[model samples]
Target: MRTSSTIRTRVTVKRTTRAAAALAAGALALSLTACGDDDKGDDSGDKGGGTKQPGVSVTLPKLDGESLSVAAVWTGTEQKNFKQVLTEFEKRTGAKVTFVPAQDPIINFLGSKIAGGAPPDVAMLPQPGAIKQAVDKGWAKPLGAEATKELGENYSQGWQGIGKVGGKQYGVYYKAANKSLIWYNARVFENAGAAEPKTWDELLNTAQMVYDSGVTPFSVGGADGWTLTDWFENVYLSQAGPEKYDQLAQHKIKWTDPSVKEALTTLAEIWGKKDFVAGGASGALQTEFPASVTQAFTGGDQPKAGMVYEGDFAQVNIGETKAKVGTDAKVFPFPAVGDTAPVVSGGDAAVILKDSKAAQALATWLASPDAAAIQAKLGGFLSPNKSIDSSVYPNEVQKKIADALIAAGDDFRFDMSDQAPQAFGGTPGKGEWKTLQDFLKNPKDVAGAQAKLEADAAAAYGG
Candidate 1:
């Protein structure tokens, strides 16, 4: 399944229904609508009197009548906030940029477009593997000097390296996700008298306390297999360490390796305990990602589960409930299963496909702090750009997430599954996704799961 991106919010009460409704409508190719009235004033600078625009820092060349099309999987509030960023670019540079909604596995969508000679001028690729695929197919363009400079100045070396293929920079990572978080109901934690856990043993103790308080400790979105992959990735990254994580992602190490077994065994501790999970293993298999979030935050003092695990984007679903984030709903880092806590992240990278002056300019603009600040303020967004101040984010929770990501810097790892081929990692009911879901249903069968995973991965990786 393609990872869905949504806006993270500070105050999401009013946006709850609209945001959910937009997501439910699916990733349709919605046309660009006017975000707000465009200023007819001087397009030179500072349209808001003499005050600088929030995200406008670099000077852009005049593209008076230039038109460009950009494609991505973002819809709903995510698309809306991004359009706001595009709107600012339009205002400052006099470019006509259109938002083209592309589906997941965006490379497939771009393939047909490239064949038809109608590819978007630019595309926001969600996975690093997709970026490589685009380049391998000779469809991606290298970043211009300006964009390259912005990337060096604003982003960490780790993020910059993710966009590079064969020693050349081909992408600008515009949006980021902190995927190793566990959001829980503050009231449930209070009722159980459980404190935030810092280690694997502590986490289990906390879970037991919540279970003892008559509430399930965790909500697993088992129906969506990607959630299951995340569960594995966090444990694997923390326990086996980054070296082994990369080896497995590249298929240099087999899934049946002892390190893999160790990770699965660790995960089984939670997955095996049916009483520790909301609705048990069978019911969890029916619960989708959205429902998992709602189950944790919907009930007043006794929600279905005390916690849900996912990226910061879970806050979008949490918004659908009456509970307020950072108060009623609070988050903690995924506890350390090994010597250190895991920081597995995912992000969207902006790459030029149909290179042009306008397209390159827009690509360079996105690399600047000016462009990031716009969406950061709109909420439900985080940027890897170190140049952007934490205050740009709408709430402290988001600020902390952004801080953690930047602090990890070059030490952090991208989502392990995302770095693998789509057939092995991104597909919905196959490869790692399916294998992990089956493992979730039968946590004790670590060896069986490892065998199945190795077979599928070998096929996908052409071993």
Candidate 2:
């Protein structure tokens, strides 16, 4: 159920068909052909001269004719934009770099390649736990001095920590997705005479008002279980705070804890509502990722639901809807469940798997503002690099997302599911996905889901 479009991040983890085909399919459309031409940099025309990008001050070792293998799950626009960065790298250092889409479960791909003795030189590891896994397995090399220095100069302390495993820096975060958004149709809210909610109670009231106005309260992609994890994570982070969030992510606390039940109960109230969900409980199982956006923002006829909860990537799909962004299509922070609004995120970390002058040079450049600014100016991207200027973002949506990410500072947490074992978070048909799907089907079974989650988590984490 992997998404078929260019959104290669956790956005479409185990996506269903409806998410792409039902709406915004073209938004995330696959780029079948290569961006063969030297397109220069982002449309900002800043890199139009084909010169090296800005903020990369380190003197790179000339690895002329040196080849490097880089792998990730990127495709379509994501791939094209990244290639532009690589193209800049090629121009700067005269190194020939090839990007290979790592087959799903990249850890295994890297594993098989390592077992065969032909692993990639550098790879963008999207799953945080996998970075830990690679480090634990001794498959990743520490970032060299140049890259480590760039990371220190450009990235925030939190971001630097994400790439660190076992007290050593092993990766650089290049692209990020702010997952704290709740996208809604302005028309729907206006029709219900509802304003944006600041607290959890207000959010619940708004949903009820929208439901009373003849539209469903939410369009949930229950079909894809990861969405459920996001729902829980946001609420849990806000309710239990970051320290407890860290404990849960590391499996230091059991899933059957009362705090776990409290979070699930909060989620169940909305997810469990009979007519509140777009396709109802059972129908939601058939509604994939993109379709959830489509159901809320679709034009003509009454929308299936009034709102959808997802990451900033929803901007691409929202733009495709008849609703106009900043007007008809609007976003609000996922309402504060506790005293504070939670901002959760996911991102890709570029790590060096094989050490070489070429790898170190490329890694160093990737951590700079120059590399991120290229994509930022192009739109539809977010980077945690502190050196990147916000004006480079093409629109308010991306800009606000980056701003929220930066403002979160010490409060922000990487996608917690991504920080856990793949068995508990990464796998699609088993573990969290299956058990959460069961929870969605029968929301009253909070105790049951808690038990199942604890059982699965215990086995996955080996405690």
Candidate 3:
């Protein structure tokens, strides 16, 4: 039920300003003070035993007996953690909030709901294209004044601009991902005497050393084609530079451009080697994303592979293993392929779909640090809201990732495939996903791959 369309917007991520950071710090300090004074019998109503949650001091209008629903494509720990944030909102505002499970290509899922006249009150959209689609369909509503004010006070200009369509705010980006990280098992590195690589060639050398030590060097989730796209994006962004990256993302240049060929040729260095990949190419082609992470971290000193490349959220999968992050498990920035390492990010934006007062209240609360701080403390989460204190994150690894993302400021790029039209970027078994999977199976066919990519992109972009 998902409708496909061309996406032309250029989504850029920037860093938080010093002034916004100061405001965030002040707000967090005030919340900490409120937490300290909980025992003083403050009138903040506590529905269950008067126990107050820390980092939740946002003042919301009382909507006792009001009912609302939120939709997002989150499952497992991600869903559980977000629900805790919603529960806190319900307790604080006396509004009953329900979590609605959504499917991939959430726009399609929402299309069905909107047609049925039962769209959720609020939806956490994962792509800017989806937001634009919703707005074009006239299903998205502008954020209320309170929410807009909170957004300006807490977020950077770049982050604010991502949610704006035709210069009107429609979304609040609540969760962010630092996608340019390579996570490795500490034991494997120590056993192979391998150091973290700083450049593309060095990474190959490290992989060779790991392989020489009789361990697979990398775990790739080839079954999920989006994971393959992530691999290509990191390499492309670092090697081709941001200018070329922007051009390709917007389809201003053809997929057959020299830059694309060069990036693919560089990726061929690793993909061309069968031993360097976990389970070989065939085995990897069967591996799913979670299994890919678990394979690299679950086997103690002899994990299936030595490393995995993914975002900050990979910690959620690492949690399912016995390896302790930052100790048994460690990470480094993606190695530089050109001048410097790349910083590619992805995030979920909360947008109002139904114009009810309670729905608007929820959007306003999501923009506040109070809501973000609750999830940030629970781990496997990062917030662009500069107001949330870094100490809330459970460990040094997540903290560093969050810091690096904010530090990137204007240099950072949103996920490339995500910015493209859905037919070309978001769909599985099609477009870049399938094309890259085919390239992985036959890394030598650079020309054929380029031709197919250009054809698919041209059709998707309506060239």
TM-score of each: 0.86, 0.85, 0.88
Off by over 4 Å in 2: 1-61
> What is the Å distance of residue 150 in model 2 from its true position?
1.1
Candidate 1 per-residue C-alpha lDDT over 1-463 given as tens digits, one digit per residue, 9 for 90 to 100 = 1333422111100001223222211211121111222222223353323234553567577788889999987776577768988987888778899999886457888888889989999998877778889999999999989889879999878779889999999989888866767888989999999988878899999999999999999998898777888888878877887678878878999999999999999998999986888888888899987789889998877999999888777766776788777678888777778876666556788999987989988998899887888877766677889998876676666776677566655655566677788778766688888899898889999999999999988998899
Best by TM-score: 3
What local distance difference test score does each model get? Answer: 0.76, 0.74, 0.76
Order the candidates by TM-score, highest first. Answer: 3, 1, 2
- Higher lDDT: candidate 1 or 2? 1
lDDT of 3 by residue, 310-421 (tens): 7767777887888777678788767778765665567888999999889988998899887887777777777888787776677766665566556544444567777778
On a 0 to 100 scale, what is the lDDT of residue 231 in model 3? Answer: 80
What is the overall TM-score of model 1 with all chains considered together? 0.86
